[model samples]
Target: MDLSVTVDDGVALLEMRRPPANHFDEVLIGGIVDAALGLDDDPRCRVIVLASEGRHFCAGADFGGGDFAADHVDAAARLYRRAVRLFEVRTPIVAAVQGTAVGGGLGLACAADFRVAEAGTRFVANFARLGFHQGFGLSVTLPELVGRQKATDMMLTARRVGGEEAYRIGLADRLAEPGRVRETARALALEIAASAPLAVRSMRATLRGDLAGRVRAALDHELAEQRVHWATRDAAEGIAASLARRSPVFTGE
Candidate 1:
């Protein structure tokens, strides 16, 4: 399994086992959604801690193969379908972002109810740098978390927001020392678990009204824009420049 789920003291820990960059594909996203859905039905699980075992939390999808959308439209649509399921889950999630969460990885982190990170942890919205539109419903989730102006700046500039700045900008809910991100996230999950499950779910649903629907709508627009951009010469140049560790010179072609 690319993911693992363990339960203790009313908290379910869902760990992504993909190492190093932890780049995700449709399969990995499906597994995560399935695990979260199953846990939501389990009475013993009241809260979930989403963590990754890797050098980076998740570096988004692997686009090093030249084909940015490897599986094309169908694959992207399926991935978004599964991702939408994550928002429908009743249990609140706390994410431990110990390392970089870039691109779609940032979307995954933002999907959670809360995030715990260290000062060195980084959050990047790198779609423009890759000459692609943001996917994984980030168009909606990003602005929802950090406001429209900040989200716009990150998306357009592809800037790296470190943990301290992330906290100040409302991206991270809690900050921890290096190596303590998971512990801090787990503590937050435990705190949530201590509450009445029914009440918590109700409150969460009320606070996050129509969020899943909004994400589903946003994915459609994002994917369409990505399709158009992926066909441009600038997109190819951007990918090549990134792989070669240089700046991309895009001509509005």
Candidate 2:
């Protein structure tokens, strides 16, 4: 649950450093919200870079590592607020995704202004596979990046998209060499960093929040959907089947 922050050349770089997969739980999610809060208030930080330090970019909530399921309801509430902050941030944001961004991690990426990843990196909405549907604002964010058809396919089928295809499909802005993801992300941030801060901030805000009311409504719908799914037998079956390496025998339960 280690989060690091650095500011240079009018850009703030925030790194997720939980090792291995950088899986985020309640505390990590709160830390993210706090970072965004700080960036919004910092005059020197014109652009913010969200990067992770690990082999895989993120694996979503750390349910197995802690009491996430016990606090799942409150966690989702906090994350919903965090998602709003991320999209409403007055500064442009860049994301460096070096590997898999599954479930909520993928949702977080969709909130970024620019997403750069390695050619081999994988992006998957995997909520269905987990028997859960807590994607925060991905219902709108993902469709905005790709399209309704592709977003539906990704979310419903729970398939993975490679970094190159993600870029071509508009889910990612650039694909870098596996070892150069950080460098490429830094370069892109520097380009934004050199721009007029006020103009850049305004443009990013407009793009991310063109329909603020609609976005919030969509978020509320998603949260409600998530609550219903999480309390269902089907979701438990999905999690059990995944953990046991067996196909889920869903009976519409």
* Cα lDDT of model 2 by residue, 1-253, tens digit: 4999999888898989987778887677678768977888988888888998878778777655465556666777666765665665666778899878988789778778889987888999877877777576888888888999999999989999998899899999988987888889889989988988888867766665564566677788887887888788888888778667787766667
Model 1 lDDT tens row, 186-250: 89998989988999999999999999999989998998998888889988888788879899999
Model 1 scores a TM of 0.96
lDDT of 1 at 100: 98
Estimate the TM-score of every prediction: 0.96, 0.92
For each candidate, the alpha-carbon lDDT, in order, equals 0.90, 0.80
